[model samples]
Target: MTHLPEPPAAPAAGQARIDDQAAKLLAAVEEAMRTPTSYRDDSPLPDYGPTPPVQQPGAPAMSQQATDVGRAAMFCGLATVPPGLIAIGILVASEHADPTVIGMICAAPAALAVPILAIARLLRSAKPEPEVHQHFHGNVTQTTTHSRTSGVWAKNINQK
Candidate 1:
């Protein structure tokens, strides 16, 4: 059988270029491995002096005295209902008074209770509270990319 001709040898200059390229790739990989990435510090800076008071919603427009007045009215309305009924019963039992007068007196307390409760709720609606705010910032890097801007640049110079 005829022998196959020997394959042509690679030129020394081409081999040198290949070796150089391999060395560069290996150095780049080594640099990527040796220096870890994504080192960052996040620390709170001190606030100067006293922080300005936080702005808030306006004061409750309603007054406490007004509330107390409403409360007093509610208390009176609740208190008077029982006594008015009792009075009506007493008058009816006496057998000398009209039932219509007793009934009118009994209805007054129930009518008054509505406005008193409404006024109390209105007053309670008027009061105010507090508020707060927050913010944050930082830099970050990854291990896979050997970016020249990062510590990996030092290794490239060392290789040279």
Candidate 2:
């Protein structure tokens, strides 16, 4: 390997001499190293601002019969399934299926009843949503608007 004839730091100077610029650069770097940054390791972040207040939603507006039916259906699906499954799991795990068929016979009827009862209640309680149907002839102008809505809503536009 051959070393360059000039010192490693000094190269060919085609334009402005870096000797003056280099001293300024080195002094700036040294000053920056000595100075503290605007950010401190121990400091907490500054607060941006408080958030806007939110309005609470209103209570559910449902008829007594509808509410009761809805609750019953909810109970059967969510409430009954878990407990029923856990009960069957516990009973089977305990290995208490006897020479007599009485244990399974009783549990089978109740377990089967849950789905039947849920289906029956849900079907009976279910109400159909109101519908809109528009029939237009030639040269008709139609406008449609759909939005967030609750409960029953019915409107007839351009009706005689």
Candidate 3:
């Protein structure tokens, strides 16, 4: 039989000490990650000083009422063609008159109505609503002014 030399036993005490130190270091890292602290403690924020006022270009302003009137007028103008066509179709189907006469009769009403309605809308929109004044008392002086121009007359407010 061949004889073999026995392997040396590992240094159990030294290995145990090293493992304990490693576990402690891992736990310290985990704790630090869980609760972070600022590098500069008890320090105030740095100031950059006062900022200069910026100039902005003034935008072209249009009143809500005027916008509504313009939109209504546009819609009326667009609507003129459809009703005229419908009227002419009805007249022709009924054999009320010649094609030329039917076209003139139908077109006249539509043409007149469109302008009248547009003018009416404009006139109605021109009437200004009562102004409202709100007063605020505080360290900062603020005054808010607004007018009530919203109603059935302002139906085309969102058209713009």
Candidate 4:
């Protein structure tokens, strides 16, 4: 065939080839990348590792700390209501008792509420939070399909 026209000369030094060989190689690389050539779905990647254990504050877990904080707030709220009522009850019940003594009793509960709430907050501060992990996945599918009759019913509701 006359030497096949000298093979049409090679690419000039470093020019990217525009031929069947280059196209095939490029296609192979693209396919390999798209299909995840390293690990299968069941296998873990090189970087895959176990999550670290969490530590809570003051030896309390996240759930327990939150509960303590809630209890503290509840007690504080109870302290407020009772103190107000006690002040009113003291004033209305007797003029013989010293107002200061009654006031002290009412204020005592509120004062106690403060330490409980403070301890709750301290416990709450000791709880641990989860670390976030990020990963990239292609072509996530999130579709829900219903039967044609179901779709028609929805459409009818919308029209109404």
Q: What is each predicted model's overall lDDT from 0 to 1?
A: 0.70, 0.73, 0.74, 0.70
Deviation in angstroms for 141 in model 3?
7.0
Clash tally, candidates in order: 1, 0, 0, 1
- List where candidate 2 sits over 4 angstroms from the true fold: 1-56, 78-88, 91-107, 110-160
Using alpha carbons, what is the TM-score of model 2?
0.21
lDDT of 1 by residue, 1-160 (tens): 9999965466465365566689999999999999977554456545776654444568655789988998899997898678867886878788757768667766886789999999998898666634534344576543333334445445444331
Candidate 4 structure quality by residue, lDDT tens digits, 45-155 = 457677555454485545878988989999978877865886778677876467677777758967988999999989987887667565658977554443344443454
- Number of the top candidate by lDDT? 3
Estimate the TM-score of every prediction.
Answer: 0.27, 0.21, 0.27, 0.25
Question: What lDDT score is found at residue 91 in candidate 1?
Answer: 80
Tell how far residue 137 is off in model 3, in angstroms.
0.8
lDDT of 2 by residue, 41-119 (tens): 5555557877554454597578999999998999778866776677667668888656454467557868998999999
Instruction: Kindly report the root-mean-square deviation of model 4 from the true structure over all alpha carbons.
Output: 33.4
10 residues in a row with least lDDT, candidate 2: 37-46
What C-alpha lDDT, on a 0 to 100 scale, does residue 57 get in candidate 1? 62
CA RMSD of each candidate after superposition: 40.5, 24.8, 24.0, 33.4
Error of 4 at 57 (Å): 54
Q: What lDDT score goes with residue 130 in model 1?
A: 40
Q: C-alpha displacement of 67 in model 2, angstroms?
A: 0.8
Query: Residue 43 in candidate 4 has what lDDT?
Result: 46
